[model samples]
Target: MDTTPQAYRPETAILDLGDAFYDPVTPANFPETHLRFRNDRAAAEVGLETLGGGEWIEHFGRFEPMPGSLVEPLALRYHGHQFRNYNPEIGDGRGFLFAQLRDTGDRLMDLATKGSGTTPWSRFGDGRLTLKGGMREVLATEMLEALGVPTSRSFSLIETGEQLERNDEPSPTRAAVLVRLSHSHIRIGTFQRLAYDRDADNMARLVGYVLRNLYAEEPGDDAAAQLLDRVVGRTATLAASYMAAGFVHGVLNTDNINVTGESFDYGPWRWAPTWDPAFTAAYFDHAGLYAFGRQPEAIHWNAMQLAVALRTVSEAQPLIDILETFPERYQRAVSEAILWRVGVVPLDSTRDRALVQAIEQGMTQSGIGIDRFFFDAFGGTVPADDAFAAARAALVGYTARKPRDHAYWSGAPCSMLIDEVEAIWSAIDQRNDWAPFHAKIAAIRHMGEALAD
Candidate 1:
């Protein structure tokens, strides 16, 4: 395998793969693993080709390089706050950034394989991922992107015919390797290491590198502070988007949060089918700190911790300014997404609030499929008046405090038609009438185009 550079950067901008990210030399071993999901299109987008054939079992999960490929082993270092407390001992653990490519669009992206055998960071544990865990990540990330959530996508999952031991699930479970594409894998822990080492020079160097690589247009002495602010703003925006979609990231660990504001590491994640603020998806979330509703707050708090790590070099006020924008930015993004889902055009604040409140009430009464209801309304294929009686009956049990047949929209005529439509489509969508769902998405896309002009 060739060790070469696809592109060159200023020496200062090169990522430093310290011992923290590297593992001691060990032969990569994987067995009996099969490719589960191969994202060839996404891989091709970044100038990568699949490396499997009839002898795939011989190469996959092994550290062998593909033809015309460069292998640059990287071990990233960063610190994180796990479960709300500072933890200095966290890093890549087992995985490393293997190579990066500049796609046809001239955008730099990484081709990273998790469970590609262990390195110095393995720390006495098998440096591999469970087949089940990798499968869960593949599903979660794919579904999230389809739903418009900004997430890292899995490119490939290869179940190594190797048996692994884990406490959480059945022992001797299968092991697998996963490849994911992302803007950057830098995290809050990345900075925490410098802060902990009190290496102000390396800290500044890392910040400058991040600015040039991650935010190239914004580079300089003042760039570090500006970079932190931008990260805060983008992080806030992402958090709000997560809330709007009713998705819960069970683990808000600092290591799991990407500095680029992309959601990574899908462990124990869930999407709420209804607007239950307290709904939790993580099985181990005994405290419920990161429940669906508290995601924004958790993000803000995580940013605060990251800000603390950055404070060694940056000013406190700018970080505070960025944190302050989180709530407002989140509100705007979430409101727009909600409005679009409900089929309302050219949204106004008053109308949005009215519709949101109405939908919340309706959800309680109708037992409607949450995502389907709004999608169906936009299609304009609502049930006839006569069918509403049956739809109404379907929703009655969902009402916790009020009668399901309370007819909440009896007086609110502006929303009555959409509500009724929601009831009818709720029933149809359950039958997997995806054609209607597809049509609704197309109609919304058309509306978006008209507004853009």
Candidate 2:
């Protein structure tokens, strides 16, 4: 009987924080509106599954207001270092926070956008996203989520009828816009901006906003330190998960690193084809700064930068002390992550550490396919080597978590290798055949269900 649109209770929490945090902006006018993808599952999480096609496009594509969501989108303000180069001017050039609402779990979720339109931050660049880029992100986020990495969900993708030029990929490419459902859009750069301005008051206010809205907790006297500690630990866990999933987030810039430790802005991301440490994702990253093996260090480096930004609100020594704990925490998180990928229960600290080392050595020396290696070695089995036997010895006292009878465990593992991704895109580009795309999504979700821990 409760058929009201506001039944889900959308809240403009970020707006309440004031306009200093962001700039009010308008969405772009596209020539055509075609709904390329709609995440009904994510919609259901925020109680919007009842929207029909026209309604979906109206809200997400045409930028029409939801019943009780934000009226004007907010282009967020923040500055970040790009490849360690401090760029004090970069913010959400094309994207903005569209709305804020609580999910089924009562956690505040952000409905945000990428390539929606230009903002005051858009300098010397057209505010648009390539359709290929949008599709890539949708696939990337879906696969990452299925692999159990904490990532933002690509909520909806609409192919705006326009052609765009780009340095990468072919020119005159189709353009699109994306809406993401995420925990928080606040990045390390958000604090970096305040620190750069020496705006300690706003820095403190930002910290308070993070604690209350993003974290759903009350702020304290040591809020910055507490937040930094939580962020560091979660970033460690996120780094370990990326390693376990064989993922290489190409751009590990401070702006891309969310304070919530939830990964977003999937651009130029790739799967490690093999176990090589120097495997780079983005084609432009010829120097391999953010490579597969070096991702942990890059993540740690970003976390430290977050710490540096927090220094404006906290003592330098105290923050450095918190940063020092990263190495030990990362070691523990990686051990747990590797064990989870192997689907084995932890026997003890020592045995688990040894098992992790064995797995790493096997990956390095075996030359097995990165995704295939995990699939074959699930449940502490396979690779048929002395090292793996020793790894199994570490697991002798415990049983596996995954059931053997699961249908997904029988055949090949769910994978998003480049070739498969290319094929999926090629279908869309040539014939507009979305069957492969839909099928891949279903398969990845099924694999996730099978591997649920």
Query: Model 2: per-residue lDDT, tens digit, 275-388?
Result: 899999988888899999999999999999988889898988878889999988888888888888788787777778888887888777777787787888777675776646
For model 2 the local lDDT of residue 139 reads 93
Instruction: Tell me the spans in candidate 1 whose CA falls farther than 4 Å from its real position.
Output: 1-27, 49-60, 65-70, 343-367, 379-453
Candidate 1 per-residue lDDT, tens place, 19-100, comes to 4434334336664656666675566666444444543334334545433443445656677888887877766666776556
Backbone-clash count (model 2): 0
Q: Model 1 — which ten-residue stretch has the worst lDDT?
A: 408-417
Model 2: per-residue Cα lDDT at residue 245: 90
Candidate 2 wrong stretches, greater than 4 Å: 1-7, 386-389
My TM-score estimates for the predictions, one after another, are 0.75, 0.96
* True lDDT of residue 222, candidate 1: 66
Error of 1 at 389 (Å): 17
Q: How accurate is candidate 1 locally (lDDT)?
A: 0.62
